[model samples]
Target: MIKHSIRVTPNRKGIWFIVNRGRIWLSAKRELPQGTYNELILSAEPEQFCLIGQLGDQDAYLLVNHDHIANEDEWVTPRELLTVSEETFQLAARAVQVALFLQTHRFCGQCGSAMSLVSWELAALCNKCGHRCYPRIAPCVLVGIVKDNQILLARSNRHRAGFFSILAGFVESGETLEQAAVREVKEEVGIDIANLRYVGSQPWPFPHSLMTGFIADYVAGDIVCQPHEIEEAYWFSFDQLPETPLEQTLSGQIIAQLKQISGNKKAT
Candidate 1:
């Protein structure tokens, strides 16, 4: 089990995830610092110490250091760890999200009182009005609408030309994953989808986002891009697709799966 907001000593030894601002401190090799707390030799005193989880036999901890550890090789965002081992990436994600949660949730939202960490849990309690807050995780849906050998790819307004990916949007307050998929597809590309197949999930910690992926069959509607939302969207053949998301991303995985399924059908 993972421990949060725990006390630790400078002599404590383990893997360290020293985070500052939104980036994490790393060695020159772009790897997390490991060893005893003092051996890590942090430039600034950490605002907090959290035992995120266990990495193998060693305990993994996050040092919330808000100071800007100067130099480019000193820090990198969690995105840099995408190509690393899944276990390492997960630990890095947890570290950053927990740090961000602690940094932002210092003050109570409802009562405007200083919040203190609960001794035995990952939450902050506002003693003034009994308000409690946990780390916020925004749930997002990734819909890969497939129609035979083609997959629908879209370039959002935020993306530049040539790059495209599957449709994605945040889940609404009272909607299922399937509902969110259908709604996001329709609103983003004016398409209808069905036969939603659950794929997998990935923790994307750009300030804490959980991406749930799905593969749905295209049902109807034309590709009419939403103004100021989607730049361009079209059904691209698996054989001849333009630039898309990397294989490390969910959209990329979905596209690759569609292509693989198509290849299998042809072989059969």
Candidate 2:
């Protein structure tokens, strides 16, 4: 239900945004009011901009391509921006999502024509052609594989320390979400999974992704980490699970759920 639910912070905070010939420019909310109008970003920013309503709240995130953060390292973990509220983080994440969508879809794929923002609705329309492009959410699956009392998880080469997660991959061209989950497990760690059951999903707007969650039982196979993709793979007993990264994300939720289920089974 988290996908259907987003937190609305408080009020409107000015976000200074710019688009040069339709490319987003980033600037702080304070600096944006004084700059030329193009595209704008209106989201939650306690120190920079005011906290605003949640995304899908009938308020469009005015997206301007401006990088105004004091520290470049701070941009990686977006939840640290301004106020620390779920709603605020959700809004900010969606803002990044919208900006990324617009940036990538600026040009029409079919005819290679320039695209313009639609007057009504959050979509881009081809200036020369009549093509309408909407925001894209790449469908992916995250699975928790459990066998006996231990659970299977992997650490990606891209993740920070202490950040391990369930096996995940993008839904392929002609595969179902469940199929993708199974295939990802095999490809990432050479493991076979069974009893794939849907748990929940999250709108990971960090560059626009919808992560579908599943819990699968480990059938067979050894811990063989995929090269370049997964740095390490391991089986952690119920009593020895590693620390899970919790940034209000789907991966975090699945880890928590896995631990809870394992604990209950041990208790009974």
Best by lDDT: 1
Model 2 per-residue lDDT tens digits across residues 1-268: 1121223243433342222222333344322232222232334231111122333334333433344434343233333432345554555555566666666887999899888766446677887879888888899999988888788878999888677778888998989998899898999999898999898887665457788999999898898998999998899886777776673667777778888888898789
Model 2 vs. true fold: TM: 0.74
Best by TM-score: 1
lDDT of 2 at 242: 77
Model 1: per-residue Cα lDDT over 135-244, one tens digit each: 89999999888887788999998888999899999999999988999999999989889999999998988679999999999998889999999999988888899998
Q: Which stretches of candidate 2 lie over 4 Å from their true place?
A: 1-60, 67-83
Give the Cα error of residue 46 in candidate 2, in Å: 19
Candidate 1 RMSD to the real structure: 1.4
> Stretches of candidate 1 above 4 Å error?
none
Among all windows of ten consecutive residues in candidate 1, which has the lowest summed lDDT?
A: 1-10
**What's model 1's lDDT at 204?**
86
